[model samples]
Target: MPATETSAASTPGAQPSNHITEDEASLYDRQIRLWGLDAQNRMRNSTVLVLSLRSLAHETIKNLVLAGIGRLIIMDGEKVTEEDLGGGFLFREEEGAVGTERTAAALPQIKSLNPLVEVTALPTLEPFVGGDETAMITFLKREKVDVVVACDLSYAQMEAIDAAAHAAHTKFYGAGTYGFYGYVFADLGTHHSFTYTPPGKGAVKEVIRYRSMVQAFDRTNWALTHEKTSEGGSPFGGYRRVLKARQYAPEVAVPVLALWEFEKKHGTLPAGREGQAKELAEITSELQTALGVHPKLLSSSADVVSHFVVHATDYFPPTLAIVGGLLAQDVLRSISRNGWPIVNLLVVDSLRGTATSSPWGVAPDPTPP
Candidate 1:
């Protein structure tokens, strides 16, 4: 039967001492030297709930478990399939393994990653759904889960999870990868603080007020335009300015939004269908234009939009690794309160090797005429 696993420090309500054991100190000696003992202790005190058990989740679970989080609960009702064996290393190709539950198949490997970290497998997400969140919020509060990560779930699903996490006063993360593109969104909820060091400066403390994912999404000023060309040309250049200011380009971002909208309306991603790419392109272009992207920029992003429409449901391992690695690292940073977490949204363009972090919904910009 499926059940929650607990370690010495993982027992619910069990209080771990502030002091690290000599054995623990010796085992985590290198990391202790890097992040300091307090941060390590913070990690040792955290319990993370990760939704889903796909390749991205596989990579994320591996990173977090290896990082020595106190406890990890994986909730995935999916059963292993032949496709799962390709990227989910926790699954085996042996006979009879394909029909096994994903969490069950991956539990041993997750436990093996770090015996010090408590690992639990949840075979169902019964109480979690887009329209309702009572069960999820209750579970989060009941388990005292420090952070919740939703992977490869729909936008509305992520919203539901984020809402529940917000209610529980827990941090939330939503992430997904498509072939060569991916994104991660965080909602640490209203107020969060962490310690950091600046160049030529001592450790500095900082605080951030974050907006929920829904707020951020709603606040994005798709109509905001940049300065008009000096020659009295079009008044909108917002797309170029935003793109120039961001570490990641909007090429993938707009397409992702369009894909979500498509999925929302069509009940599936646009893939392997006749004229779907063209329809998706139309949607992307329409969104890009509506979102105030420069006409030239929209044209330049056509190839990516085309690729995204066709392969929107596909996954690539290398892309998953890059995105998943960052996602895991950020989750730990949020837990340890040691480093800067992604200030909300991070979009990665694997084809160009560029990942951009943008703060959405901070303030609404007037739509450019």
Candidate 2:
């Protein structure tokens, strides 16, 4: 049976703790040695809301729970199917898990990972699905949610949830895995972090201002041109130089963008059916031209677009593990403020075993001397 809808505090025997117990300290000793006890304590008292229960979410939840987060609220309305068993290790057929609500199926395993972390299951995503964010904002405040991790959602859905999180003054992360490729988008509004500058210089505090998902992907921002002094000093050098200099590879970035555009236009992702690849290719070309990317730079985008269109809905465990690990690491960093968080977007290409981060509508503060 599906789990009933519930509040953040509805879980039995799961209550928020103000301080970490000595046993917890011993359990997290290695983590404490790595990032200090203060950071671990921060994680111990933080509450995170994860919106989804797919393969990606499974890996992320495992990591966060094992790390001793104070509270975790998982929201998902879908039921488990046989296909989910492939990458969703949290679900088991032996227990008659198929056809049951995804969160209910996974809750037991998540609880087993760490008994100290309070786990709440929200069987519905009602508040976040609609266009209005009022309900979502209210829910975040009511639950005192510190962070929101939305996984495997569409571009528009993520944008709406991110807006709600921003309104509630909560950090937000949007992550998804597409077969051999995956991406994570973060919006930590006006975030501050402390880092060491030199061996004896002590720690320096830095602030990073981030743009919402919509602002980051705005077509106008993509169209903006910059002066190029090297290529005949042309004032309209296009975004090629700017984008090429970023950490992301053009082949992966462009196709992903095209996939988003395609979804927005069609109201759904292509199912690797006939002619879908060609349509996606056209969208890729249009996006490249709109973004002023050089044709040669993305000349090989056709193969990538086709590949992504076919495998976009497919799930590969290795890709999920890689992307999910990155997502969890960044979430912990954001919550603890121990290290610098992802400025904006992170792309993982499992085929090449490379993960790169690119700033989208956000810039890092200058390093202190």
Candidate 3:
């Protein structure tokens, strides 16, 4: 969600505020100490694309909107649900459909925090990653999106965003949190770099550390040939037939295709256990396709963090605060339009009270061709 068009913030309803709300001012007090109101203004004028509108996704994004980021494209095909209300704090039980109904549902809440900020949310968002990367790439190229903030997404989707950002010459910041810890990776296109945040590590970096999990399964057909004595201790039985009946899971790419199909069939997954199963199944299927695709496909530190980072934040607001605060810094450094380095890797370990950072050292912002 780049700033293709200047926002309506100066409009009567979307006017900027002089005094921030008590709660909001309090919540963002520390942030003001770091960047001050000037940076907040930059945020108000900037447009950003948030990858998903789930728990963590919604949280970070809402913070941005409240903090006064002018425009937002909250990309997601799913609608709100009981589970969404449970996990996504920004949403309420009385809220209407997320994708179809609320284009500005979250704006009022943001206004409560900062009346000056202007926000318009969009649903029915498409995935940024795909084997058919051309569509999203071309879209972003035309749309003039300034930055992309992606949350817990698939491996290929993360890679697709990285490539799209690079090709379109935009900044891409990928962040995710799970249980207690998460990492943020900033790619300053072919130029620039993140100054404050670090790169990715731990489970988030596992995809890069290990070759394609898909390819491994493809080579051995391990899932199929896997034979074991049944609980009843049957003979060397289930093994032989199991291997013969189906194709290798990875080669079949059932997971990827299935995810595609699930979205097609079910526009809005039901909330609660049912929704989790539906989404999990789709992702598992997508993983299988990685076997046949290029192992390096969609591989980037940001992509890695977005895909593998497990988010345990039960609600949305906290997630948004964390992501918004970190990503906003990256955007500020990028707007300098001067020499800067993109962060290559950032491992934030709460246990260590440390953030492992790998920067592009220093470079100039790539003047878009």
Question: Judged by lDDT, which candidate is best?
Answer: 2
TM-score of 2: 0.88
lDDT of 3 by residue, 1-369 (tens): 322222454544544444444444455577667656555545555667777766556556555655556566665556666566655556655656444333244444544555444444555455464335577777676656787777766444565677666677766776654433445666654434322322352211101111111222223332232233111111111332243212111211232233334444554222334345546444643443422332232232222222222233333444445544565544554543322322333434343344444211111111111
Summarize candidate 2's per-residue lDDT along 1-369 as a digit string, tens digits: 233333324444444456666678788999999988888989988989999887899889989989988889998888999989998789989998999988889888887787777778878887887647998999899989999999999998998999889878899999998888999998887655555345577666677777788777766655443332211111112443554433346667777888988888888888988889888888888776666566666666677687788788989999999999999999999888877677677878898898877666653322234
- Evaluate residue 36 in candidate 1 and report its C-alpha lDDT on the 0 to 100 scale: 92
lDDT accuracy of residue 51 in candidate 2: 93
**For residue 23, what is the lDDT in candidate 2?**
72
Model 2 lDDT, residue 162, Cα = 95
| C-alpha TM-score for every candidate | 0.88, 0.88, 0.52
Winner on lDDT (2 vs 3): 2
In TM-score terms, candidate 3 sits at 0.52
Provide the global lDDT of candidate 3 against the true structure. Answer: 0.45
For all candidates in order, the CA lDDT equals 0.76, 0.78, 0.45
lDDT of 1 by residue, 102-191 (tens): 888888788777777778888876566533677788888898899999999888788878987888889999999988999999888777
Query: How far does residue 288 in candidate 1 sit from its true spot (Å)?
Result: 2.3
TM-score order of candidates, top first? 2, 1, 3
